[model samples]
Target: MELILLCHAATRAMKTGHFPTGDEPPERDARAQLASLHALPDTRVIASPARVARETAAWIADTFEIVPAFDDIDYGRWRGHSIRETGEREPEHVAAWLADPDARSHGGESVAMLAARVAEGFASIDRLDAGRCIVVTHAIVVKVALAHALRLPLASIYGMNFAPLSSTVLERASPADTWTALNFAPYE
Candidate 1:
């Protein structure tokens, strides 16, 4: 089975440096990126249960099938706060959150939790029914998925950053299967 993980289109919140709450509009560059991804051949299309993710998937598929399991990490009390503001107001929490993969200092989901959720979401997809699927979700979701696919520690999520509309393709024949390729580029 092939899984194409596409981070949601760039949101105005991303460009403006604010935590996204699924209400931001897609930026110009993100629209172009979505158009580029849409040209790929048809496959099963799934999206996280977020407005931004659903809108992004709609760019590539006729129907927007919502996958609640693939939803973005809960930001908790930090939702809608700018990074700078969060850091300034809660420096120690921010520090711990960034340094500890299991830390939920921000009162949100930990990196470990995000990785587990994304892995569970992928595992829930039936390879026999749909061998190939396109999953549109947030950058954090993409990062967590990548860490799971690559068998990296949850902290590795911090070492990687995904751009809007970036795609990471992973494939396996079964639930117990190992990755066949790391960073797959379909167009190339």
Candidate 2:
């Protein structure tokens, strides 16, 4: 099975370094990047329910299944706020969240929770009959999927960068086999 995880296009909140509120639309240039995803015959497309992800998927394909498992990590009170602002207002909370994957001081989903949710998403994808699948989601979701596929620690997410409209490919021989990460690249 082959899986292609594609990050959604850039949004104003993304450019401004604010935690997403799950309602931001793609930036104007997003349409130009639509050419990045070429026509692939017999490919199944799945997307997070977030508006941005859904919109991105719509631009690439006529139809896509909305998957809650691929939803972005909930930011709760930090939503729509810059990371810097959140840190300044709640230094301890920020520090704890960064230091521990289970921390949820922001009253949102923790890193560990996201990892598990992403794992569930992968399992569901594996059950599909399609040989090639594409998932449209957020950068964080892409990072989590990569980390799961590569068997990297959750902390690795902090160091990875997934640009808007970037694609990360993963493949496995079967449902029982371990996944192998193929490549990470942004659509030009």
Candidate 3:
């Protein structure tokens, strides 16, 4: 099975350096940015429940299943705040979160928690008999997926960057086989 994790298009929060609230709509030209993407026949399309993710998926397919496991990490009190602002306001909390995958100092979901959820999401996708699957989700979710597929430490997510509309491909011969990262590229 081949899995394609597609990051959602840019949103106002992304452009302005604010942490996403999971409710922000994609930028006005988001669809235009994804105009080049064409879904292959027999591909199963899935998306996070976030508005941004659903809108991005719509650009690729007329219908897609909403999967809660692919939902963005909860930012809680830090949502809608600029990274710099959050750091300045709660340096200790931010530091803890960056240093520990299980830290939830901001009262939001921890990296470990997100990873678990992403694992569940992938498990369901693996159950599908489709030859290919496209999951439209957030950058963080994409990073988590990559780390999970590669069997890397959760901290590895911090070292990865997945631009909006980018796609990361992973493949496995069967449900019992290990996943392999095939490619990572941004759509032009």
Candidate 4:
């Protein structure tokens, strides 16, 4: 019942800051990133449909499989807006949203919504294994999953650094099936 979550490799889309917003794991140094994660032995993987995720998962070669349920939080209309544009166009709204991701974005999913979806996705994986199963997904999605496990506030997602190519291990022991956040944002 142990689940390992890994954020997708960094992508130019992340740097462009206005191309990918939904569940898409933007393309980046994934081919290289895969090498680091794949080195670990005996890992079961669940991946999102994002291009970058799919590409990265390819290298693992049957190690981690695709589970659409593991896709990222949907950003809705604000999907591809750059941070600068968002801040400039809606300063106060942006600030408040940052303070509380639960606040809905321009026609988009809220933090609570994100948390709910991520939980459902995680629950779907509960039966996949008795040990660790690595999950490859987007940053926001990973954080939401982490938040659900730790019972953390959504506003706190900002302070948490979810850099690309990072790893977090979430464990759910058998019987009781309680999930615990073992470690977060491991820079590896």
Candidate 5:
């Protein structure tokens, strides 16, 4: 199986460095960038249920399946709040959350929890008969999928970066076996 993980386009939350609250879709420039991608044929498209992801996926394909498991990490009490603001208000919580993948001091999903959710989402996609599957999701979801495919620990999510509309292709060597990332590129 082949997995084409595509990060959704930028939103107002992204620009403001706030925890995404599923408020806005891609900006004009991000729409243009998404339009520049080549057409994908004979592939199944799966998108996160977030508005930003759904809107971005519509630009890439006419039809797609919405998968809630691929939704942005629940920010809970921190939703719509900037990381800087959160840190300033709750320094200890921010520090613990950043330092530990299992921590959920923001009263939201932990990094490990998000990774597990993304893993479940990928597993369902893998069951499909399609040769290739395109997934439009949040940066965190993409990073979690990449870390899972690469067999990296959940903490490694902090080390990776996925720009808006970035693409990361993972090819399975054999059915249900090892997988390798063919290429990881930001939108040009």
Candidate 6:
């Protein structure tokens, strides 16, 4: 079987001299999840190129043997902007984004773009061995992929909470297969 263990995006930029704080995903204990996962024999970690994911992989590199791949949607002009700034400057735009993330922002990627990137990320899974493969990607990427796995409409992605620093195991009988809601967020 093959398992894609999705991880969330950069919850901490540390560039500000402190952890990046926001009303976003959860801030998890990396050490706990790393110590736990009874990962499969052929398990390989694929993480987004983002710093948080990269550093996270570094902590567990020897155990997981990670390879960098996949990235989250680009927020473009909103890249470094915080929620307060965005809300104040672009109320209508923010509302629209909340309503339908699939709608492309002026300079950022739409949900569809993210879905395409995730599709590209999964391209290598089939040719590999049948054991588990853990892919540590962004939160939005996780939602998009899970939505793809569940065959859920892309529009509902923002409504879901794909656990940060968690695993949504996708075990299967064979590589040429698919399923929905295999196992929701399991705590660390």
Top-scoring candidate (lDDT) = 3
Candidate 1 weakest ten by summed lDDT? 179-188
Candidates sorted on TM-score, descending = 3, 2, 5, 1, 4, 6
Query: Candidate 5's error at 105, in angstroms?
Result: 0.7
Ranking by lDDT: 3, 2, 5, 1, 4, 6
Span of ten consecutive residues with least summed lDDT in model 4: 21-30
Residue 68 in model 2: lDDT: 97
Tens digits of per-residue lDDT for model 1, 1-188: 77888888777788888887766656753454456556344468889988888877877777757987688888878888898899999999989988887889878899888877887787777543676788888888887888787788888888878777778888887778776555734322
Candidate 2 Cα outliers beyond 4 Å, as residue runs: none
lDDT of 3 at 36: 58
Q: Which residue pairs show backbone clashes in model 6?
A: none
| Superposed Cα RMSD, model 4 | 2.7
The lDDT, on a scale of 0 to 1, for candidate 4 is 0.70
The TM-score leader among the candidates is 3
**Number of colliding residue pairs in model 3:** 0
Point out where model 3 deviates above 4 Å.
32-36
**Each candidate structure's count of clashing pairs:** 0, 0, 0, 3, 0, 0
How many Å off is the CA of 72 in candidate 1?
Answer: 1.1
Residue-wise lDDT of candidate 5 within 50-111, one digit each (tens)?
98888888887888999988999887799988989999999999888877889998788998
Write model 3 residue lDDT over 81-152, tens digit each, in one string. 999989998999999998788999989899999999999998898789899899999999999989998899
In candidate 1, stretches whose alpha carbon ends up further than 4 angstroms from where it belongs are 29-32, 39-42, 182-188
TM-score of 4: 0.83
Clashing pairs in 3: none
Cα TM-score per model? 0.88, 0.94, 0.95, 0.83, 0.93, 0.79
